[model samples]
Target: MDRLHRQVGAVGLAAAAVLPGLSAQVDQHAAEVRDLLGVRGRRPTLTALASYTDGLLDGATGRGWQPPQHDLVGWAGADGVAVRLLALCALVTSAVA
Candidate 1:
């Protein structure tokens, strides 16, 4: 495999590894957010996290998101809550770094 392929494989593996944990965190966050906002089941937390994390990994490795979603904020948004948390982590890390 090429360098890019290896890196991609690694990122995919890392994302997969943390997916469950990230989903759990996102679920917690979503629950709180929803409760605060007085909404129910409003966010597709797990899927969004995975999608966002994938997007971040791609961005960090100099690859753009492929087949980007038409709507990433709402119901038709990205998949996997782990991905979403990755993006959030990136944003926070960048802000603090």
Candidate 2:
């Protein structure tokens, strides 16, 4: 039990140390995505995109349709597309901050 605890502690420390680098990478990627979408430096555009995607998800849920578990990126249909777009908006906003 003691050895297991130490192993877990070490793993946690390692993860903690890596998190900042991971965050920076994510922010960089988000900036790239925002640029590709032509929303860079345009807060209004990003906000509108987020709102539209949110509405799409809400509308689908209102109709009692289930989003596919394996297609969170929207490869399957409308549900996934909305999720992916919303995520992109979120990433862009986070990067901007």
Candidate 3:
């Protein structure tokens, strides 16, 4: 569970920094993350990330993604999950801004 805690904290920190200026609307920040992960209205933990990615990409592929892979990241060998996280992190940045 320690690793999960760390992951959550890291995500939160990344969110905070990406938020530009600090504010106490943590719940709002959290809501944005959930929405990006497509897991809103529920509490999220580390493990939900992989499942979320799988679900999101499942539909994304037919739209131009090619699946167990995609060109979203443009990296020759970056795994799908990594691409998902990068996308999710980027979404979080946008969600708040």
Candidate 1: count the clashes: 18
TM-score of each: 0.27, 0.32, 0.31
The full ranking of all candidates by lDDT, starting with the best, is 3, 2, 1
lDDT of 1 by residue, 11-93 (tens): 43345345665445444644554464444554434344345445555775464444222222221233443344333443332
Clash totals for all models, in order?
18, 2, 0
lDDT winner: 3
Q: Give the runs in model 3 whose Cα sits over 4 Å from its true position.
A: 1-31, 35-43, 66-97
- The candidate 1 region of ten consecutive residues with least summed lDDT is 67-76
- Residue 39 of candidate 2: its Cα lDDT? 75
Model 3, range 1-97, lDDT digits (tens) per residue?
2332233334543444445332224445445658875767754555555466556556766566542322322233434433344444444444445
Error of 2 at 49 (Å): 4.9
Candidate 3 versus truth, CA RMSD in Å, comes to 10.2
Better model by lDDT: candidate 1 vs candidate 2:
2
- lDDT per residue as tens, model 2, 7-94: 2223322332345543344346455556766778754364555554457557866988553333222222333333343345445444
C-alpha lDDT of all candidate models, in order: 0.41, 0.44, 0.45
Model 1, residue 52: displacement in angstroms?
18
What TM-score would you give candidate 1 relative to the actual structure? 0.27
